[model samples]
Target: MGTNTILDMRGYRRPEPGTQPAYLFPPYKSTLRRAPTKPLVLLPHTLSEVTGPVFGHDAISPGDDDLTHANGGEAIGPRIIVSGRVLEEDGRPVPNALVEVWQANAGGRYRHRNCQPHSPLDPNFNGYGRVMTNSEGRYRFQSIKPGPYPWGNHSNAWRPSHIHFSLFGPAFVSRLVTQMYFEGDPLLPFDPIYNSIPDENARKLLISSFDWETTVPDHANGYHFDIVLRGRNETPMENKR
Candidate 1:
C-alpha cells in the first residue's frame, strides 16, 4: 500500500430530502451570488479527510467555555447558559467533539469592522467560545443573548437572535456548521435563512428550548440545543459551496 492510499471505510449516508436547504435560495439574496450554476460533482472521501487530526483538551483553554467573562470584565446583557449534546445519526453520543460558537453582542454589534455601525459594541464581550464534548457527548457554555440586526436583504429585513455553531465529529470530513435560534423568536418567520429549510420539523430542531434546570439563580438563563449529525431528523446545516 502507498502512503496516499485511501481507506476503504463505509461511506457517509445521504441526507433525507427537504432536511437541508437548497444551495440556491432566492429569499436569501446572498446565495444568489454564491450558489453554483453547474451540477455539483460529488468527490470520494480520502484518508486525510476521514482520519485527520482532531482538537482535544490540549487545544482548549480553561476559560474558553465561558464567553461572559472571557475578557477582563463581564459582558453587559442577559447572560445565558447553553448546554447540549452531539449525537450520531443512530442516537449514539459523539464524545470529545470540538464544539465552537460565535455570536454578536447584546446590542447586535460584532467586533468585526464590517459589523453594523448603528449598534454599539460591548467591550467586555468578544462573543466567541469553544468546548469539547464530554464522555456523554454533552457540552456547555455561557454567553450573552445576541440582539437582532438589520441586514438589508429585503425591506425592513432583520435577522433573529442566533448563535453560530461549528462541530467536528471525529474527523475533518465530519465537520458541520449550523445556527441555533432562540425559541419563540418572532423574527424567525421573517428570516429567510431559517425558513430556507423545507422541512418544518427540521427547522424546529434549530431552535434551542429553554432549560430551567441549567439556569443559575439570578445569574443566567439556560437553553438546550442538541445536534444530530445525520439522519431523517438531522439538524439543518449551512449550504455547501
Candidate 2:
C-alpha cells in the first residue's frame, strides 16, 4: 500500500506583489463643469392640433375603406380602437401633438429586417399608422391585435405585444420616443424592450388597460393608453392670463 502526501503552497507569485505598471493614465477628475446657474427659462407655445393638414410625406391616408379592409381581412385579427388623451404633466390638454404608432400585423410579423419566416405576413398589413391629437388632446387609431412573435433566442422567446409611439410636442424641446404594451402579457418579464425602462412606474405607464367601453360599435376589444408630455407648470401669477 502507498500513501500520497500533499504540500500546502499558500503564497506563490511568478513576478512580485506591488509592482507598479507603467501606463499613461489621465488623472481622475469630475467631467461635469460648473455652469453659471440662472433661473430656468420657460418657453411659451400653443400645442399644435393633430388634425387637418400637416407636413410629412409619410402620413397615412385616413380612408374608411382602409380601416374596413384592414378589419375584415382574415389575416387582420381582432379589430380594436386605440384611443387616448395626450396631456401635460399638470393634466392640461396637449393639442396638436403628433402621435405616430407602428406595430406588427395581426399575425405578429413586422415590416422590418430579420423577421421570422414561420409567421405569415399580412399582405394588407402595412404595419404602420399615425394620428394627431384633437382639440382636447385626444387621438384614436383603428388597428388589430398584434400577435406575439418568437425570436431566435429560445423556443419561448416572444416579445410582449406592443406598439411603438413617437411624440413630437408643441415645441422642439418636447420630443419623446416610447412604446405601449398590453397589460397582463406573459412575455413582459422576458421581453428586452419592455424591461428597458428601469422605473416600475414608468414601465407601468406604457401598458394599456383593456377597455370594453372604448370599443367601437362592432368591435369587442379596445385599449386605452394616455400619454403625458413634459411641460412647464403654470405658476400662481400665470393664473391672471
Candidate 3:
C-alpha cells in the first residue's frame, strides 16, 4: 500500500454501538427457536488479512463504469450518471480506492438466477459497475434507475431502487461499503432497509441529488452522490437504535 492508503487505514474508527436498530435491518431473518451460542476466537491480522485482492491496469476495460451500455448493447431504461467522492471522516480524500457497485435493472430484476420469479431479466442490462477513485477522491459512472422489487419480509415489502457499493481502503479494517439511494423516492418512507439506520440525517446522506450540469442533453440525466466513508461525526455500524 502507498502512503495515502496507510494514512486512511490508520484513521479508521469503527462505528458507534447501539445506533443500528434490529427491526429495521431487512436481511436478518426472524425465528421462533432459540439461537445457537458460539465462542469468540481472536484471529491474527496478518499481511494477507490486511490487504485485499490486488489488480492491474489490464483488469479494467474501457467504459467499465458505464452500465448503460454493457456487452456492446444499450440497456432499456432512463439512463443516469452517478458521481461521487470517497472521503475520510477528517475530510481527506481517499485516492485510488476501488469502488464496486451492483443493482437491479429498470425492470426490478437481477441477472442472477435467484431473483424473484415475477420480474423479467433484461438481456441488455448487466447491472454492475466498478471504478477506482481519482486522485481527488472522485468517481463517476453511468447506469439505469433500478426499479423496486417485491420481497417476503413484510405483507408487501418491495425494496426501493438502490445501488449497493463496496470500497477497499488501505487496510483490511478500513474497508467499508454502503448502499446509495435516489432522493425523493416515495418508497423511502416505507423501506425498512433505509429505515434500519437510527439517524435520519445519516439516512438522508445515502440519497443522491439531481445534477443538471452533469446531465447530457438528449441522452442521460445526471445525479451526484458524495460518500464519506467514516468521519469524525459518523461512526461505523452500531447496535443501538
Candidate 4:
C-alpha cells in the first residue's frame, strides 16, 4: 500500500473536503502570473553585499556557549557552520535571494510538538533563522548539529538530520520549499520526507557536502549546501510555444 494509504488506515487525520492535503500544498502562493522566457541569469560567484544579520547570533560559530532563547533555559550541543551558494539551474549565481533555515537543537530535539518532554528546551534554539545571499549568492550560519528524533513509524525509528530551507528567487515565480540533509545520514533511506522526492537526482540535490574550510573555531562541523533557483528561459520567436 502507498505510504499515505497506510497512514490514513492507521487513523491519521485526513483533510476535509475543499481543503488541501497538509503535505501536498505549499504554505504560500506565488504572485507572479507569467513565466519569463529569456535565458536564466545565474547569480554571481563572489560573496559581497551585507544583508542584515540572522538569528541565533549568540550561538553562531563553534563554541561551548549556551543558547538561551527569549523564553529561558539553555540549549546544549556541538557548534556547526552551515554555508552554501544560491545558484540558477544553469549554474549562475543568484544574489539577493532570501534563505531561511530552521532545525532542531543538539539533543535531537525541537521546540515543536513532537519533541521529547524531558529534553530541556533552549530558549535560544527557536529553530528559525534567515540570511540573504551576497553578490556571489553565498549564505552562512552557525548552529548546533541537530539530532535525529523518533516518530510513530516504528519501535526505533528516527527522523534524519536535516535543515529546512526556504528560498525566494528574484522573481516571485522562483520560490522553492525544500530541506537539506547531511551526507551519510542513516535515516535518509527511511525518512518519509526524504523519500517524497521521486527523482534520485533531485533527492541527492538536497544532501549537502561537508566543508572543512567553513568550520570556524568553536563550531562542531561545517556544511556547504547550495541551491539553484529556476530562472527565465530565453527563446526565439520561432521557438516559443
For residue 59, give model 4's deviation from the true position in Å: 20
Candidate that beats the other on TM-score, 2 or 4, i.e. the better one? 2
- Indicate the worst ten consecutive residues by lDDT in candidate 4: 44-53
TM-score of each: 0.90, 0.67, 0.79, 0.66
Colliding pairs, model 1: none
- Model 2 clash pairs? 48-96, 49-96, 50-96
- Relative to the unseen true structure, what is the C-alpha lDDT of residue 110 in candidate 2, on a scale of 0 to 100? 86
lDDT of 4 by residue, 44-147 (tens): 21112112223332333333222323346444677777888999766889886777678887666788886666456666677777777778989887677787
Candidates by TM-score, descending order: 1, 3, 2, 4
lDDT of every predicted structure (CA atoms): 0.85, 0.65, 0.76, 0.64
Candidate 2 per-residue C-alpha lDDT over 62-124 given as tens digits, one digit per residue, 9 for 90 to 100: 642123254445446887778889997668898777777788887788877778675887777
Ranking by lDDT: 1, 3, 2, 4
Candidate 3 accuracy as lDDT: 0.76
Best by lDDT: 1
Candidate number with greatest TM-score:
1
Q: Judging by TM-score, tell me the better candidate of 1 and 3.
A: 1
- Give the residue spans of candidate 2 off by over 4 A: 1-60, 64-75, 152-156, 233-241
